[model samples]
Target: MGVFSFDDEFTANVAPARLFKAFVLDADNLFPKIAPQAAKSAETVEGNGGPGTVKKLTFPDGKYVKQKLDAVDLDNLSYSHSLIEGDVLSAELEKISHQTKFVASPDGGAIIKVNTKFYTIGDAPINEEKAKEGKEKAVGLFKLVEGYLVANPDAYN
Candidate 1:
């Protein structure tokens, strides 16, 4: 098996606490409502909205992914999850884990840092293009939430 990792950071004009509440905590409810074209819904399949919870995200095309929440720290504005099962994982990928951190910036916004680790099957090397695509999707979601918060200043406050 081969293991690969990628790190990415994006700055958003939203507070860390608010962003965490909207994007990390309430995403299952807010995402689909705000960007229905990208995600049909996100629902908790097992456990509550906490660590060890299983959440499934369904796309508009009917494809879905199941993720197991590993950790959540509202105080630190960080969360981690592992992809337990999903159509998003190709045949070459055996597992994928993600960690995200939202740090408060001096400007009252936040800096979102994401770390993704990909484990490949057998001798198959990790696909950089696919990894990049995943990162782009995350960025897109963040932007969508940021835009929503910008439009409604009182939201997630």
Candidate 2:
């Protein structure tokens, strides 16, 4: 399998604690509500989002993906997820999964970094179109979270 990397970083206007809590801790509940068209819903299938937990995401188009919580350290401000099954995009490249980290900026905002590794089979190569789609998805994540915070400033408390 060939591995392709996608990296994205953004500085959000919200505080680190706020973005982390809203985006990471409560994402299972928050994201679906905010962007129903993209994500139909998400739920805690097992455990409480700590290491060893699992979350299931249902796409609007009826596709589903299972995520295994690889590591989560609140103090370190990082968490990672590996694809367990259900979606070919993740199932095919199970080893190269998704990870996100948050770091507190000295200026009171937060730096959010997200990375995903895509895997493709055979010599045909992972289509560049798919890679472009992945990049757009990363950007959409930030926009989704930011939109939520903008609409409901007091949320995630």
Where model 2 places Cα greater than 4 Å from the true spot, the runs are 88-92, 119-124
lDDT of 2 at 17: 72
Model 2 lDDT per residue over 1-157, tens place: 6777878777877777778788778887878888888789887799866888887889988898787889877886787887676763633344447788888777877788889876556433566675678668867887789778867889865
Residue ranges of candidate 1 with Cα displaced over 4 Å: none
Specify the poorest-scoring 10-residue window by lDDT in model 1: 126-135
**Best prediction by TM-score:** 1
> Which digits, one per residue and each the tens of the lDDT, describe model 1 over residues 1-157?
9888888889999999999999988898898999998899888899987798998999999999999999998779999999979998989988799999999889999999999999889988987887888888889989999999999999988
Residue 123 local lDDT, model 1: 83
- How close to the true structure is residue 97 of candidate 1, measured as C-alpha lDDT? 97
